[model samples]
Target: MPYYCDLGPGQKVYLDNPGPTTLITLASGSAGQQQQSSTQIHTGPWTEVPQIARVGSGALLRCVTAQGTYTWQIQGMQIGAAPTNAWVADQATPMQATEVGLSSMASMQPMAPMEPMAPMRMGDMQMSMNPMTMRMGNMTLGLDAPAASTQQFCTQCGAAIAWGDRFCGSCGHQLHQP
Candidate 1:
């Protein structure tokens, strides 16, 4: 997908699964607060303008970026680490039926759009021990992070596995699979 921007206030951007899920709005703030900034989501070649409003870092915002990646920018996080840009360089590599859990024979279709105005909950503040501050566009709902286990690829058999597996079913390699 080509790059684009989210130019509207309150507008949301959704990304394909396996990519970032949200983008929050941000604007000028007092001391220690960030300066007024615009949030944009670029998808393929279209740049969307968002509705206008003052928003903070911690608020959950959602939008897909110009790189064909989805992102979730929480109000409190830095723009560089915005989930959308996290793997911006990591474009979708077609995975084998076994690699992506998708069969080659199956028809590939985009998923249905999620319900608009869906209620979203961030991480558990108590367990995460994070702060509880809200900002405009405070909630971004469509982002999905891959499980930790999905990040690993078996060195011996070239298969992906949970962090530690004792054995590789594909190549019969030994692993401590987490």
Candidate 2:
């Protein structure tokens, strides 16, 4: 399905697709200068803009499936504004049908503007104890939790150390437990 999110001033859209491939496009301004990226959806989340990128008002995120049928979800967060709007679009017809020039393919039709639903506060979202499950609108994304840290940095010489080390490997400084 194709999805759209209005990222108001200082706002950004976050997408997490734990499986399948997706194409993300960003359009801004009246001229519709666009930037696009194709990403393989692994177990980690990805964003349309860099975490540090400055997002202005009216930024739009357009996402479409690259292949296969898959469940997808996305959420928007404003830098200093609260989360309020959630939009969901109907499932997009598979690329195969559209590419073949099937006369019956609905994907060729222009998408209607999505009506804004009731606002969802950030606090109203549910988070499970297991990090994998995330709910965005009506879709649930299962993501692999990032691995826990098993390494530490040595204070004396700034060398890398395994979690249980008792001495600094580079400078021989005694390691103290905090």
Candidate 3:
């Protein structure tokens, strides 16, 4: 978009988009009449007048130069990255119900109905949580508990055994399967 500068009553000079690094031109009407650049408006090697204040987006900038006084309006293509007051929605494109190799029904398969998960039942479960202290610089944080051993032991000899073991390792005791 172009920037409009008010020269006087019933007069406007269109300037090329006002970006800092871009070479600003006096867009169609004022072309070749006066030589001006974005650097001249922003940084200013102006003949007499320099920039007055930090130019706001969509705000009028009043400045004077060898050409004349100009009331340049900052509209489109701002000096830097600025937020626009427009809202845009993101939407997905609709896909066709047919594939190159597969049949049309293959792309439109019936979804499986979801069922409720079975409720978990824990009978006589014993747990002990051990929190560990972690130190980083001056911040100290507590870590998650380490898992406690739930290994099965032989009742007669009190020897550690696998859950489905028929006999204990330490003593050759036969284990009763529950």
Candidate 4:
């Protein structure tokens, strides 16, 4: 059996599959615009469908089962204001630190001033500084300059391709100028 329901914008539907294996498919959008379809297999008792958002009023949900009839339920309903408990709010209020019988002796005492240390000589410490330099023929080996490149990513699969590569290595899609 198959079931259909119209869902509003920013609304989500939940299906309760207490029976055997069930296949669920969702379709949404208008005729001119591209319609999206998502299919999933549910073996658990409860499964939530993907959130659907339509511009005007064109959101539909379809659920079908092969073994037996399935049940469907809708979630994310706009209900009224939630009920409040006065006793819970009063108990949730935090008590003061003094009222809780917690006292910090360090906070009550004045902090001592820190003294400056004397500068030690290089000989006093067992460390030494050395300047290093490397020259590859006439050019100096340094990371000051950036490397030149014309690398680009493929539009189809987003794989890293060289500046003038013809095809993508990962997805094997052709790259051409139109």
- At residue 43, candidate 1 shows an lDDT of 41
Error of 3 at 120 (Å): 19
For residues 21-46, write the lDDT of model 2, one tens digit per residue.
Answer: 43333223333433222233432333
Give the 10-residue window scoring lowest on summed lDDT in candidate 2.
Answer: 95-104
**What is the per-residue lDDT of model 3 for residues 54-94, given as tens digits with 9 covering 90 to 100?**
23323334333444444433444333222322211121111
Please provide the root mean square deviation of candidate 3 (C-alpha atoms, Å). Answer: 23.5
TM-score of each: 0.20, 0.22, 0.19, 0.20
Please give the RMSD to the true structure for each candidate, in Å.
23.2, 22.8, 23.5, 29.2
In model 2, the number of clashes is 1
Off by over 4 Å in 2: 1-151
**Top candidate by TM-score:** 2
Worst 10 residues of 3 by lDDT: 87-96
Give candidate 4's TM-score: 0.20
**Candidate 2, residue 134: how far the Cα is off, in Å:** 3.2
Query: Whole-model Cα lDDT per candidate?
Result: 0.36, 0.39, 0.39, 0.36
What's the residue-level lDDT of 155 in candidate 4?
91
Q: Quote model 1's TM-score.
A: 0.20
List ranges where model 3 is wrong by over 4 Å.
1-150
Which lDDT tens digits does candidate 1 get at residues 1-178? 2122232454222222223322222333444543443333334432333212124323223333465534344343234334533432233222111133221112234665655443333453211111223333444233244465358776797887665567776888887644
